[model samples]
Every structure is written in C-alpha cells, then in structure tokens.
Target: MAVTFYYAPYSTAESTKAILAELEHGLPNPLATRIELSISAGDTRKPAYLSDVNPNGRVPAIVHDGVPIWESAAITMYLGETFGVRAGNDPHQSSLYPEPGPRRGEAMKWIVWTNTTLTVAGARLAAALPVGTPGAVEKGSQDEVSKDETARKNEEEIARGDLAKNLKVLDEALKERNYLLGDQYCLADTHVWTFVSWLSVMGVSTEEYLHLTEWLARVGARPALKDQ
Candidate 1:
C-alpha cells in the first residue's frame, strides 16, 4: 500500500517528512508519495484537502492508503509504529516507537508535553511579537509571526516569560539524558526538534540552555533530516 504525505515546506509538516525519511532510510519503507501543498496558494485550506485529508485544514497530514491522519504529534506516533509493521517488525518493538517499556513511556510523556505545552506557549509568544521584527529563520515557509494583522500594543514580555518557563523545564529535563528518553534517539526527538528549531522566531536564545543546544545539533545531524 502507498502513503500519501501532504506537506508544506518548513512547516510542522517537516517533522512528519523527517519520520518518513528516517523509516525509508533505515529500510525498504512503504513511503510512496509526497504531495507538497502550497500554503500561499491556499492549498491546505482548499475544500478537497479539508474534506478528505485533514478536517482541520492543516499541512503535515498523511493518507496511508486512503485512511487519513492529521496532527503532527499523532502522525509521528502513527508512522513510528505502523511503518515498523510494514517493515516486518512488531509495532510494540518498533525502533522508532522504542519497544514497549520505560523508553516508550518517556516518549509518550515528551511527545504530549511538546505538542500541548511547548507549542502552545511558543504560539502565544509568536503572536505577541511585533509584525516585522526580524530574527526568524527563513526556512522556506511563509512567516506567520506577522499575522497579528490588527494593530495592537506588543508588550510581549508576558508571552515570552511563559514560553521561557516551558523551555527551562525542557532544559532541566535534558541536562543529563542524551535524548528525551535517555540516550537513544526515537520519535520524541524527532517531534520535539521540529518546533524547537523555531526558537529563533520566538526571540528565544539557546545559549542559556546548553543541553538543548547540543541536543539540537545531535538530532539535526541525522542524515534523514537534511532535506525535511
């Protein structure tokens, strides 16, 4: 069966593309088609994509042989385990999913934390930043930091502070472990790195968090992640 990956560059969809790349790089994977959507052309918001692919009308969606899946975090876990089965490995023992054990539990923990807490805080910070302020990396996708179209006072200290709290938690969590789940690289690393790389856009410097900096280098060094 073929997988149809709907995407837009430099968006959250890159994380899902990274997973697909990793699976294919490691073995003869089931990853088949990659459909690049244009956020500028309103591709993601189109009627067909909204109805059949993602009801939420977002990129980074997957239609694995017609069954649709959305949400990058959910897609990460889905592909991690499902691709393992297609590769003749037990889903519970999947390399990306980390078998069923403590590592798996930790993976679940960090994934939920990144999606719910980290991303929420970051979005708030991005929303509060001034419309044309520079420093966000130009990773090919359109910048939404300026989407606060209505003129408003940008006293961004509060939003920045909230995100700082979350980042510090991540810093402390990674002070000792190599990855979110100890030393082994797994799905959590893949999912978390997706947004963590956008700290430049949030006006957050990584120099304060040494562990996070090193971890980014480590994860970003992976061969499969070069393009996506």
Candidate 2:
C-alpha cells in the first residue's frame, strides 16, 4: 500500500513530517512505500483537493492507498504504527504511543502539551508579531514596543515560559535518562521535536532556554531528519 503525506514544511504540518522522518530509519523499509506531498495553500484549499481527500481543507493529511486521513496528531500516530521502525525495537507491541506505563504517560503529556499549549500560544504570538519586522536585532530595537506589541510580546513570553517549564521538567526527568520515555526514544521525542524544530522555519527563535536549546539540537541531530 502506498501512503501519501500532504503537508507544509514550515507550518504545523511539519510536526507529522518530522515524526515520520524519525520513524523512517526504524521502519523495515522507510521510503520504499511512502510519498510526501508538500501542500501549499493553493493546493490544500482547492475543491478538487478537498473533495478528493480531506474536506476541511486543513493540512497534515495523509492518504493510504485510496483512503484519506486528516489531522496532524492522527497522521503521526498512523505513520508510527504503519512503519515498524519508528515504533522502536518492538513496534507491534509499542510504537507511536505505548500502552499505560510511566514512559507512555510522559509521552502522552509531551505530545498533548506540544500541540494544545505550545502551538496554540505560539501561533497567537506569531499572528500578533508585526509581519516582516526584520529579525530579532531589528525587532528588539523598536522605540516604543506598542501596547499591542507588548501584549504580543507577553504572549510570546508566556508561550516561551510554558515551553521552558516543560523543558525544565523534561530536563530534570532526563537527569539520568536519554529520551523522554526512559532510555528508549519513542513518539514523545518525535511529537515534541516536530514543533520545537519548526520554530526557526516559522521565524521564531528559542535563544532564551538553554535546556530547550540543547534538547532541540539533540532532536535535530537524529539521522531520520531528512529533507522532504
């Protein structure tokens, strides 16, 4: 069966793509049966595209054979299960999301936290930021940093603070462990890394949190992170 992934690299869709990439090397035959479709706005909203597959016109959709699946979280879960590799050693028994256990519980926390709390606040702050404000150097030097700007800044601060909170928790959790889910890397890393990795491509920076910085680097260094 051929599986086609529809998404945009710099958008929230990248979450699924990153997770799939993490799964690639773990799978028996990673790229042998999968196709990725970089869905641009023009493509996703098209009647033909929507009618043929997802009707909501949202991104991160997947089509396996003739069947289409929408939603980023669902897509990642599906890929992790479909490809035996991403599931880690025993995919059939534990992949994507493992059964109830300490690691599984933490994995669920990070996965849900990344999308619900992190993405939502980040997207809002991103919307508030003055478009094309140049880079950090330029944005930092603004004379007044308006109230609206202040609010947006607060939003970003809040988001980053929350991210920091989570990161700190993970870092402490990782005191002696390597991955989020114990010694074994699993869906938790893939799910959280997807969005954290997208910050740069999304035009956001993560210079404040040292732990987060290191964690993100480690995740980015994974071999499965390949170009689309």
Candidate 3:
C-alpha cells in the first residue's frame, strides 16, 4: 500500500514533498498518495482528520501501513530507508542517505541539528517578525500588538542576530564542500535546504554568504525543488 502524505500548501510540508519527489525520480511510482489539507481553512481540526491521521492537527504527517508518522525529518528518513536509497558504507552504492558509518553518522548529526536546534531558532526568528498580511498577527496572537510594538521590535532584532549567527555556522560548513555532508547531496541537505529556502522566503539575504549562495543554487536546480 502507498503511504498517505498529508500536506498543506505554503507550509513546512514542502520539504517532505521535495524528498518524495526526488525519491520518485528513481523509485517506483505511487510511492505515496498526497492529501492536501486546508490548514488555513481549519481542515486539520476536523474530527476525522484528527482521529485518523494526525492527532496533533498538523500537516506533513504520513500514514504507512496504518502507522502514523509526524515530523518532516522522520518522514524523509523513513522514505530513504524504505526505498533503499540511503548511502551505505559499501563504496559501491550511491545514495542521498549515508549508510551506518562515519558519513552516515555525520548525516544523522546534521539532520537532528536541523530539525531541533535550527528549527527552534527559525521559529523564534519568525515569531519576532511583523505579520506580512494585514490583520494577521503572530501565531498565537488574539489581536495585533498595538502597545508592545517596541518590545516586539527588540525581540525581532535579537532573533535576527541569533539567526545570523546560526547562518554563519552553516555558511562556514559549506566552505569545504558543495553539500552538507560533502560533494554528494544527502538527506542532511534536504533538511538544511528546506530551512535555507524558508529563510530566503522570509526575506533573509543569502548574498552575504557566497559559498552558501552557490550551494543553494546547485541544490535548488534539482527538479524536485524547482516547483517547491
């Protein structure tokens, strides 16, 4: 049976979609069936969606053989292992995911770091930014902040500083190779690239980091990421 992918447009689920897209290039067709959930319309709150798919009421969840899996990183890792595309220690088979060795260990480290630490930093930065759309406030805001404007600006500035520090670390990491792990694109790239794309969309300038910018262009050229 094909895995069922729950996604919402303009959401973090795009990372999951990109990973699946890359897998589909060389793997079997119908690897997963997509179900677009209208998150902005409150489709995720429906009882059926909550009870059957993801109890947390979030997009980018997946159901495979009756088992539900949340978290975009986990979904990508699952797909990588299930499809036999993960890079192994055998210097023969090439894959996006490294096998159980040094390369694989490096890949695992970055994946976890991206999903946890980096994700938190991104959320903090995003939370501190002004709402792009009129009348739209922060995630949990019941109304616009008319009085705490100064406080919010300070927070945003601090968040931007922290995000820049994190970006510098990533920029330096890319100085030695094209991708996160090395010359070859790995699952770590998928996770990190998603954040980079999000940062770009959030109006963060990539021009400052030449190596990182070049790396983004290379990975962004992938057909799977083009539409995403």
lDDT per model vs. reference:
0.74, 0.61, 0.75
Which candidate model has the greater TM-score, 1 or 2?
A: 1
Instruction: Write one digit per residue (lDDT tens) for candidate 2, span 122-161.
Output: 5555554565442221132222144565776776677656
**Model 3 segments more than 4 A misplaced:** 84-94, 133-147
Candidate 2 ranges with C-alpha deviation above 4 Å: 26-41, 85-102, 133-170, 200-210, 226-228
Q: Any idea how many clashes model 1 has?
A: 0
* Poorest lDDT segment (10 consecutive residues) of candidate 1: 134-143
What TM-score does each of the candidates earn? 0.83, 0.71, 0.86
Alpha carbon lDDT of residue 153, candidate 1? Answer: 36
Counting clashing residue pairs in each candidate, in order, gives 0, 2, 2
TM-score of 2: 0.71
Error of 2 at 7 (Å): 1.6
Q: RMSD in angstroms, candidate 1? A: 4.0
